[model samples]
Target: MLAALHLIFPPRCIGCGGAVTDDFGLCAACWRETDFISGLVCDKCGVPLPGKNEGRAELCDECLTIARPWDRGRAAILYRDTGRRLVLALKHGDRLDLVPPLGAWLARAAEPILLPDMLVAPVPLHRWRLLKRRYNQAALLSGALARAAGLDHCPDLLARPRPTPSQEGRGREARFANMADAIQVARRRQGQIMGRPVLIVDDVMTSGATLAAAADACLAAGAASVSVAVLARVAKEG
Candidate 1:
């Protein structure tokens, strides 16, 4: 039945626009083009780096400058053309069929760091932004991950109160300032989050500001610890 549906609809890969046999949302060739992030990476930021030299030595220049509140981060891929195109299509094009595969990739990337008693939440968008986008990609990612991991996912644990302008071209400090206090713990869901370890989800991590802010909000709400899981990490050089 699934194969017949694929034949009828002829789902094409987001990367190459060629036919996809499986539900991975990518063609075989495009799947090979999807580079997984590997080698040395910052213990905190998940940014790839040269092979190990010493203790915490390969921390990206950005990670060296700014302290992130989350305990750690995991990213399945480096954000380049392939990752960027995939993420954009998933977000703007209503390609939600990509969620399961994307979540599975994130789960695998994050498995080594997985901790017991983790609660999952997504970085929320402001009501205005959510309305405009018609959906929150992060939430979909979070829900899928939680289901796959057997973790509890609370989609409404946090609420975005303000609509900051786009973070495009914004410096790290500006992004932090823009998101400050823009998120508040949903008072109604306080019981579910208080004193629990949180795994915050997002489609990508760029400057680390958004995830940091979300972690801070969770901590303030009494979360024991906060970790981040993202589909891709925007490479500093790219």
Candidate 2:
């Protein structure tokens, strides 16, 4: 039956809809174009650095200058090329099928920060945005990551009581100001987060403002610690 289904609909690459040998994968061209982050990275933001991996934590210049409420972070890929395409598809194009591979990538990136008792949660979307979008991409990724990493997940761990405008084209400080106190722990679910370590998942991290707001909420809710994971990170051009 499965073979018949495969014959009827052969696997296609997630990146460009080209035929491929397996499901939930990129074609060879897309794979080559994708910039997966590995080796040395900023301990706080997960942006790839220029050196070999030493047994020490290093901070990127941005991380050193900026105040990040989260304790640690990791990103699966640099936000460009196929990486950008994949994220945009999941976020705006309703490509639900992308979650599995993206979630697997997130899990691998977050392995360095995963803890036995850590709770996985997504940065919440405003209710209005959720209504329009029909689903939260971050939540989807977080749930899949929890399952893959053997961690507990709470989709409602955070809430966005007020809607903020889009962060596109905004300067760094403006983005941070726009997101200040915009997110908080859901009152009803506070018990699940209190005294627990949390790993906040998001589709992408650009200015780090959104994640900072989410992390601040977790810390305010009495979470023992807070960290972050994202499918892609926006790195500065050289």
Q: Please tell me which predicted candidate would have the highest lDDT against the true structure.
A: 2
What would you estimate as the lDDT of candidate 1?
A: 0.83
Residue-level lDDT of model 2, residues 1-238, one tens digit each, is 8778889999999999999988788899999999999999999999999999987999999999998999999999999999999999999999999999999999999999998899999999999999999999999999999999999999999999999999999999999999989999999998899899999999999999999999999999999999999999999899
What is the Cα-based lDDT of residue 80 in candidate 1?
Answer: 74
Separately for all candidates shown, the number of backbone clashes (residues 3 or more apart, or on different chains) is 0, 0
Across residues 1-238, which tens digit of lDDT does each residue of candidate 1 receive? 9878877888777677787665567777777778787767777777777776365535677877888888888888887767777888888989887788788888887775667899999999989889999999999999988888889989888898888788889987898888878887899988888888999999989888888888989999899999899999888664
Model 2 residue runs over 4 Å out of place are: 1-4
TM-score of 2: 0.98
